[model samples]
Target: MIELPPTILQIILNFSIGLIVTVSLNIEVGFLNLPQFGRLLAVLSGAIVAAAVPGRILAASMGLPWDANYAYHLYNFGIVAKINNMLSENPGLSIGILVFTLVIVALIGGLIGYLSAYPALRLKEAYLGITLLAFGELLMNVAWNYDPLVGGTMGVWVVDPFRFVGAGGARFTFAALFIFFIAIAIYIYAELLARSPFGRTLKAVRDAEVAASVYGKDIVKIRTQTLIVGGSIAAIAGALWAFFTGSMKAATYTRLTWTFWPWAFMMLGGIGNNLGVLFGVFLYTVSRTAIILYKGTLSAVIPIDPEWLEYIMIGLVLVAVVLFRPQGIIPERPTLTLPEHKIEMISKKFNREEK
Candidate 1:
């Protein structure tokens, strides 16, 4: 048995990954009303960049063949070892590279977001969702066949900048900062956005595009901005995951892991509710982790494969939640965007109606 403590820590690390994914998705679908089914595309951008960009940078710095070819892939692994040795010898460079990687990842992610908006500009919400999903699938196909992006199926060892902390401390330290600090910071930003006048405009557009336009809200701009911000955040989250795992495999960033699960989380945790998002993520993450962790123990008792059992249980929970609790665990509370006087007027009218 792999000791409960390490397993639990691993689960928490993965939970933070899911938490960031779900929250970013919530910004797209729940808050902004963009049905971003192709969110995986934005995320994969981070992974691809993580593999292709940073590796090239390190390779060039160390006076190696950093070109796009089989020769490069064959020798890059050795070069990476040297880079690690250098990082170990110079702690300052190690930390600096990690920070630099994250910064570059954010910029690349933002660029992906900017590009992802083109499809949304002309398509209706439903069509836009389908188009986005198709685009993601298309990108995956290309990446898999193209050796340069990430060695096709062979994948690549992503930069693990946290090596300075040693193996055990690295993951724990990253997980703590991301889950508690980064995730919470993003949540607060989302909440603040939701309560602002701008957030009210997003709701207006979401509720009725025609009405929003009539009232002077730029529907197109709002939607595009949402996609840009949401997609960028999603990419950073995905890239951070790649760095954490210390590898970049295209298949690992599949629709099921980064896309579908987040949709389920957003729905299960009341849409437009950040607190609800966190709770929903916790519930599903724990359940799924428990199933995977105890699979062997479970197989000894039950004949069915634990993998199959896990999927079945997840599907059942999703269906049950959708059918019985559509509004999610914490039902969305309506945003109070009106001015005090306007709110008072509405209250007075309701009181008058009762009398």
Candidate 2:
């Protein structure tokens, strides 16, 4: 059997993660006109919930005490190990846990979205963005200091479904496949929504809120719906992150990692174009992964620190993209709502009189 290079496997994993988050971020900033700078809030909800819930659920099932303290937290880790052993013996339990975790992640994510709309959505974009950013950081701080939330600063280990797989490469390969398929499913949904009437309303709202409101569209309703959907999708990334790393840390969901990079992916890909997200995420994730993987080798060839070199390169690439192709690699295309036949007939009618 041929094995994938670690770097290539890592790139695929990062791509899967970037795909979902970038696509969802597009829905809010591009489609909904909500510049959600704190978009990491939904993602944090997923990782935090994923950390606290499953461990507690499995613990309760095993009659282990679930409490707010370091001792119980250690006991919980033991329970997770015991559960992992049981899952190895019983595959059914593992499958159930996997499905249950994802569904709950979506629900909690949607709730975060619903709540976010209240405070920030009504404000102007500049203020709204700041509000959302603050909220995200505030929750992350709470999670970091609050032990019951996610074992506090110590973090919590999640029982990955792949634990039974045993082989490290096999586990990563399986996760990559899982993430790829899930990303595909999300892509299809985004494409369909981008072409639908509801999507048109969002575009209208994004273009001009006052104009859309004049046309009887409820601005609040549209924004709220967009947040709920986008948040739910983005949350999946956090759950997958937990599964991928086999643990959750509040620091892991920091604004820089979860929020900024996704915004970069969305902007570089074309703000309003879902298809552009695929290209953007691939380029960023692969290039970023390659840079990290070769940091040691590259440092030997250059006088600068590896970290500074990476930032310089990334900054240069971003500046070049902004200067050369401000609309991104694939600029946002006009939405087509007309039927194919109708469009063709209209074109023929226009040409017939001239001919």
Candidate 3:
């Protein structure tokens, strides 16, 4: 039996994947200044890729026929792959097929993000939110009805990516490593963007697009660029999650809950600052997991609805954040400092441009 600590650790690891999804969204909303809502699209894309790749591998190993809907579904969803292929002349080709699936999904998702920016750039607040919400609903509907996409309501079995390491290695170890590396990369990227010149432009666009335009900035182009980058990052996070969980289901990708939850995380943590997003994830994860576990224990003795309690807790936290600390716990601060060489170079460039 797995010990309590290890079990909790595993849960933390799994939750971290969710965190990546939230962080990716925060970059768009908080940093890039887009009122977007498309977390499901990215997560689904990654999950499907992760599922398909490893599923084919396991099915071939087990001697089960490929093209078996069950096997295909499992592989595509990132569930455990356990079947054989009848159509293929070579069974070994499954591995290659899996890689292809991931690439295709990522590209498709990136395209959607790029295209959406046209409309996203024009709308503000409520209108933009509505448009994105509609897009998310449309995607979810497609996932649900399209059997080929995710296996319908039954969902598909997804082959675990770590399984590629073989049965001998502990699965949890691989999961931890994947999460750690990806999380670190995201952190680095977030900080880099937060401190970069482009990042400053995003803030200007965020605060006042009209003013920014008067300053010779193209609001549409900057926002479009922000959307593209944020969308791409989200896709990468989804792909990583797919590898971690080994499955993608339509139910997993909805906007009302999954998408909005990240917004809450950003607002609670401190919007406009990456560090606040990180802090929010840490706080939310702990409260959520720990409370659920405690509630489970308490329910056996007294009687409490777990889901309702969580909802109530989340709502209260959200209200508190909005009422008191809208800027977020950490809040955005001024940290503008240019090095001597860069300052001189900028001064020379400005003088030359003027001349």
| Number of the top-ranking candidate, with TM-score as the measure | 2
Question: Residue 348: error of model 2 in Å?
Answer: 7.4
Clash count for candidate 2 is: 0
Off by over 4 Å in 1: 1-4, 69-72, 169-180, 337-355
Per-residue lDDT tens digits for candidate 1, residues 251-277, read: 777887788888887788777787899
TM-score of each: 0.88, 0.92, 0.80
Instruction: Provide the overall lDDT of each model, using Cα atoms, as 2-decimal numbers.
Output: 0.76, 0.83, 0.67
In candidate 3, what are the lDDT values of residues 153-260, reduced to their tens digit? Answer: 656665444454333335556556657666767778877887898888888877887898999998778777777666666666666665555556767776755677
Colliding pairs, model 2: none
Q: What order do you get sorting by lDDT, best first?
A: 2, 1, 3
User: Going through the candidates in order, what is the number of backbone clashes in each?
Assistant: 0, 0, 21
**Model 2 segments more than 4 A misplaced:** 1-3, 69-73, 338-342, 345-355
* Best of the two (1, 2) by TM-score: 2
lDDT of 3 at 279: 83
Q: Write the per-residue lDDT of candidate 2 for residues 196-228, one digit (tens) a residue.
A: 999999999888889999999998888889999
RMSD of 2: 2.9
